[model samples]
Target chain A: MKKILKFIKYMMTYSLLILLAVFFTFPFLWILSTSFKGPENLFTWPPQFIPEHPTLENYVNVFKRIPMARYFLNTVIITSLGVVFQVFFASLAAYPLARLRWKGRDLVFKLILLPLLIPMQGALIVNFITIVRFGLYNTYIAVVLPSAVSVFGIFLMRQHYLSVPPEIEDAARIDGCNEFQVFWKITFPLVRPAAMALAIFAFTAHWNSFLWPLIVLRDETRYPLQVGLAQLNSVFEANFRSVAAALVLTMVPILIFFYFTQRYFIEGYKGAVIK
Target chain B: MLSRKAQVYLIAFSFLIAPLTLLAIFTYYPIIRGVVLSFTDYNMMLGKAKWVGFRNYIELFKDEEFYVALKNILRYLIVVPFIQFFSILLAVLVNKRLPGIRFFRTLFYVPVITGAVVVSITWRWIFHIDGILNGLLLHMGLIKEPIAWLSDPRYALCAAMFVTFWRGLGYYMVIYLAGLQNIPSELYEAARIDGASSRQIFIRITLPLLKPTILFCFLISTLAALKIFEEVFLLTQGGAETTTMMYLIYDYAFNRYEFGTSAALSVVFSGILLMFTVINFKFFRAGSEGR
Candidate 1:
């Protein structure tokens, strides 16, 4: 009887989990079903959860209607540039702030974090003007330049760096290693996981960035995937099938990327938040 | 020939030079420049500004849309509490050592990872006049006519809020889940061995331990709700009286080319955000000290 009761409880838990999962993912499933529907009446009294006659017509139309490849390339360029800059600069800036004892170290760190309290809404127009004045109005760098140094990235790296045992660096220094050698040979390698986590955060942020890119990039060819997908949304307002296909295309890569790197997200948050 | 102290200082400065230069040009310079721009009539063509003093602020106070945007953002705060409540519940639900829990977590996070554009567009379809939501309601005999979720003024903001709530749940759920995991298992085991119920264990242990995470989430979500723009912009195009402060700032600068007024609105919005943040910090400190 006890065994039977345990089985029933397990079943109940799985049932509840499945139910909530459906609630979360049904929209994506509905879009998937819509993307494959073949010229049938899409608006029915009872919405179809599956396409009666599946076709690749909408997918083909999505590629034809817009420069999907160019958008994808642009997104890759922008996301890569953003990720490299954020991780590189954050790691460098955080090293001194976290490890080295210099005059004004605490003051500089405090100054960097001060902006977190001040909202950046006011910077929108001014940054745009700055970008234009720099003769980078239509360039991809303009999209990534302003946000190249993420304060949150710096904070996260500094936290991780502080956790590293100082003795390891001191031993390296006692062996006649210089400051740069100590950072390169001993300290940075210990914080590789934290750097990986910061990279992942920067990746998703840059991948999903829309507004700034839309404002900066005047040429259609330079439009990132998010901005491009938004353009498709308006252009295909009445054509739900094409829009569904485009959304699926944009979603798959990131979902796949997340699937592999998701463990880092949970672990990263655990390390960053708990302390 | 350099002293050890000076060499260390020089290395630190070199490491900082690039990042600091970028931050100054992008983050620091803009804060002061934005305020100065608010007091001038900015000309894009000549890249010049003529002093206008209080003209922009006076004009902003007189605009009716400004008040509508302000009220709508406050109403948007209605989502924050609901999101927090649901997300905490979700974090608990998926916190078990069950099989396929990671898959379920990923499913829930799809809306967030897909970015705002895809989620908004996908939702726009579901909320269409002949959309799935109405179809489901009608088929279930709940209502005779289809409710225009996005178009009708009565339901438009509510629909936007629902989307925001939906998209935010998974993001916060992950954070809360991390918090949940951080709680030592020994605490739960101790409670169980002491003849305590699950409810008692949760109330006595989990909630208190999760306080810091809860405070952190609340502060960010409150700020996010106030600064909401993408949903309003995508779902309704700021139509049907759903314009928000961020939308107004964007509209004034881009759509109307009123940089001075836009900068003024941004300053106002930033002040509002800073005030809320200060309040959150004070409340958090008080709560922590009370314990």
Candidate 2:
């Protein structure tokens, strides 16, 4: 009797879980179906849950109609550069804060992070004026420079750095490795997990960055993926498939990047929850 | 001796020199300039500013749109925290060592990484007149006519609210699950041995210990909500008085091309957010430490 009752409970839970999964999964699935359907397929009554016929023409139109490649290229450059610098600079910044027994380091670390709480919107007017003053407004440098240093990345490296045993560095120093050399050879390798974690975080943040890029990059040629997609959505009248196709194009790379780095996904969450 | 030692210490700081230079030039410098610009009429095109003192803040209080935005945002600040509190509660319910639970978690988390664009797009379909929501309502006999989910100013804010609630619940739940798991099982075992019911155990033990995680989630989510930019921008365009302060800043800085007023607005907005966060932190600390 108890076994049957237990089985019933398990069945109920699994059924509910499956239902919820379908609810969550439907949006992405619907997008794929929409992108694959014909132009007439979009406004069909009772909206087709499944595509009767699928086509790649929408994807083609998206590229041909607008400079989709430019957007993708721009996003790739910004995201890649942002991630590299964040990890590199974060490592450089976190090392002294964590390992090197330096004076007033704690005070300096806290002070540097003070700006994190202030919203980017708060700095918009000043940043815009300053960027224009420096003649960098609408330039790619404007898109990348303000976002290069991440406080969260610094904290992630610092937290992981705390658990690293000091003797590894001491051994390196015994071999006549100076502070920079020790950091490059010994400390860097030890923090691979945290670096991977930071890479994923920085990558996603830069990939989906919208508002700042939307404001700064006035030239369509210089626009990132999100801004460019917004432009496509606005101009492409009654063309849902092309919009859907463009959306799919934008999202797929991040998902692929995510799929290959799924292990780091969980590891990143673990690393973040350390505090 | 101290001066020599200080000089050497400063000289060894190569990383600091460059980064601090960048920070000073880009981050800190702009902030100071913004504050100063708020005091003056620093028009970008005019290439000059007239100092007007506290007139900006004074007029801001009298502006009706400012008041409406403030009220809506305050309502958001009050209500959204409790909504997420309920979400954390939901997460706790299903965080048990039950079958196929991890799948549910991933399902919940799927909407989070979809980016704001996709979320806004999908939700538009969901809330359209002939869309799934109205279809479901009609099928269930809830209403005779289709409701304008984002059209009417009345339902517009509510529409934004729903998207935020749906998208944010998953991320907060994940954080709470982590917190719940970190708890030692022996405490629960000990409580059970002492004849404590589940509800009592939760009140006395679970909620108290989960303070830090709750604090972290609450702070981050509130900050994210305070920004409240992308979804509204995508959905409403802040027409029909749906503008939040962040949108207001965007409008001033970009649309109207008023740098001085925008700088003033940004200062006020940051002040409000900073004050809100500091107060929250204080309350959180007091509540957690008092018991």
Candidate 3:
């Protein structure tokens, strides 16, 4: 009887989890279905989970209506630049603070934390002024510049660096490695996992970044996927199918990226946020 | 061997140069500029800015939309605790080594990895006047009318909150899952041997130990709630009801070109954020110390 009761409880738990999973996964499935349906089959009396007549006309329309390819390329450029610079600078700055003994090290660490206290959205007005003053407005550099060095990245990398054994650095020094060589050859590679995690985080962040890019970039040709998609949504407000298609286009690349790198993303998040 | 202290300093400085320069130019300068600009009458279109003293702040105090947005954010923050609770519940459930659990975890995290625009677009469709939600409800005989979930002011903010909760649930769950892993299984075993009920163990051992992670998630979620702009912009375009502080700031800076007003609002907005952060820090610090 006890064994039967245990089996029943197990079944109940699995059923609940499955029910919740279906609830959460429904939207993605719905969007995929909607993206394939034409306007005629879009809003039936009962909305279909699976399209009656699936078509790719919406995908074709999305490209023809707007510069979908251009926006995708622009998003790629901005996200790549932002991620590369962000991770590079973060790791570079993190080395001295993490492994090396230096004066004012603690002070600099605290100084980096100052930016964390200021809500990033609240600083936009002045950041806009700074970007214009540098004559970078409407340029990709303007969108990427403000976010090039993340405090969170620096902090995360610093934490990862601290866990490395000092004996490795001492051995490198004995082997005639200079300080720069020690970092480039020995310490930096050790934190590649953390860096990979940071890269994924930064990649998705910049890819999805809307407000800053929306404010800085004036030309429609220079707009990233998010801003361009927002404009497309407004411009084609009545066309649900094409909008769905555009969303799928914008999301699919990152979704694929996330699927492969999710484990690193989780590890990196644990390093950065958990402790 | 080059043992010179100056060379050691130079290498360190070179490593620091790029990030520090960028931080100085972009972050620190803009922060000071944000404060300075707040005091002056800076208009982007006018091509000149002059000191207007407290006029911007004075005017801001009377702006009805600012109040509404502020109130709306306060209301939106209600999602923080709700998300935290559900996320913790999810973390505990998924912490088990069950079959196909990885798929369930991935499914939960899908919306989080999905960007704000995509999430908003998906939810907007789901909450459309004749959307699937209404279809499901009508099919189940849950409601008679196809409610205008996004269009109706009464439901607009609620709809946005629902989307925020849905998107954030998995993100926080992952954090809590990490926290749960850090916890030793020995504690659960000990409690089980003591004949403690599941509810008793959760309340006494799990909840108390998870305080730090809970506080961390609260801080993140609260700040996120305060900075909410994309959802309002994408879902409702700040129409009927869904205006937030960030949305209003965007309006003043981008649409109206009132740089001074935007800066002033930003200063005030950041002040409120700082207050909350400090409070949470104190609470977390105290909680950890108590334990």
Q: Which candidate wins on lDDT?
A: 1
Give the best candidate by DockQ.
1
Q: Which stretches of candidate 2 lie over 4 Å from their true place?
A: A39-46, A116-121, B1-12, B93-103, B185-205
Per-residue lDDT tens digits for candidate 2, residues A80-173, read 8888888887887788788776688889889778877664444677777777778898988887777677777777888888889999989998
What's the best-to-worst order under TM-score?
1, 3, 2
| Per-residue lDDT of candidate 1, residues A51-93 (tens digit) | 8899999999998999888999999999999999999999999
Give a tens-digit lDDT track for model 1, residues B169-223. 9999999999999999999998899999989988999999999999999999999
lDDT per residue for candidate 3 within A1-275, as digits (tens), equals 99999999889889999898887878888788888996565666666877877899999999898999999999999999999999999999999888878778899889987888766444698888878877899999999998899999999899999999999999999999988899989999998888988888898799889999999999999999889988876778778888888888887887787778777766766666666
lDDT of 2 at A119: 49
Q: Residue B25 of candidate 1: its Cα lDDT?
A: 94
Best by TM-score: 1
Docking class of 1: medium
TM-score of candidate 3 to 2 decimals: 0.95
Which sequence of candidate numbers ranks them by DockQ, best first?
Answer: 1, 3, 2
Ten contiguous residues with the weakest lDDT in model 3 chain B:
B1-10
Error of 3 at A119 (Å): 3.3
